[model samples]
Target: MRYIVLFLHLILFSIGNAQQLAGHVYDKNTQKPIEGANVYLDGTTLGTMTNKDGYFAITAKNKMPNALVFSFIGYETITVEDPFSYDKNFKVLMKEDLIGLEEVVIGSPLFSRKKMLAAFKGQFLGTSKSASSCKILNENDIVLHYDPDNHVLSASAENPLRIVNNYLDYDIIFDLSDFGVKYNFNTLEPL
Candidate 1:
């Protein structure tokens, strides 16, 4: 009988220790709930987005109060500590604002315009540079060309370099638009 009582007490204690926190996110100025905002319990996979009404919920895994990070495109990211304090109904207010300055863009839609432009132009940092261009062929191979001094870069892939998975990166530090185009610039060994 005593063991049964102890078991029940342990179960209740664990349940109380692992309290759940849930809430909605909103724009502090708009006075409207934020929808589709990412709400994560700090370093855990326990995350979800606010509903159309800016509502979200998650069970805390530890006794320590978890911080909730609310993020969305355009609006500034907001963080909440001790989310469980407010009766599990957390409210987050974020200020809407622009992110980019000058000619720099922080983020964009997948397969976005910036990505399209950079796909052929490439990314640059200091003295590092890379770029590429390709021509559709009638066969099964891509021919690539790089003429640094002559200013000519090109490639022709017959099969389109098909594979299960592929990874690509670039580093562009100089511009040789006068030379032509590159099919793909990969390595830049400093000479």
Candidate 2:
């Protein structure tokens, strides 16, 4: 009888100790809830998005040591090292990443814009078999620039790139924070 009582207590204790991170993401300047913000454990596929109310909950269980990443397009990504430190309904304030549109244009007369984009996509998305089936839904949103003198190419996007990976059966909303490819000095080829 005593062993049965101890087993019930252990079960309840374990249930209570389950690690669940719950919080609301908001714009720091506006103090408004940030809907659709990606909340996930860094270096892990476990993730969830903030609801319309900016509320999100992710169960990490034994994975509390991993940093929790809060990401949304146009906002600075936030990483919390100790998510367990915060109580439920924790407020995560994210600041906007100020990127001027005029600055995206680093034009080089040597390489055509179309060619630069193709190069960017090649390096950004590898030439693997799975990549063959991947498609960028919003190619227009991508901004590319090349510097022939330096043999360097850079790319950025104002919005997240919607990618359809038919081979993987996953729709990826990739926020291209920054991308660049530099050519090998001797080969003059993208390295």
Maximum-TM-score candidate = 2
Instruction: Give the poorly placed runs of model 2, Cα more than 4 Å off.
Output: 1-13, 103-191
Where's the lowest-lDDT run of ten residues in candidate 1?
A: 123-132
Best by lDDT: 2
Q: What is the lDDT of candidate 2?
A: 0.83
- Score residue 62 of candidate 2 by CA lDDT: 58
lDDT tens digits by residue: candidate 2, 27-55: 99999999999999888888999999999
TM-score of 1: 0.47
Model 1 vs truth, CA RMSD: 12.5
Instruction: Tell me the TM-score of each prediction against the true structure.
Output: 0.47, 0.50
Total backbone collisions, model 1: 19
Q: How many backbone clashes does candidate 2 have?
A: 0
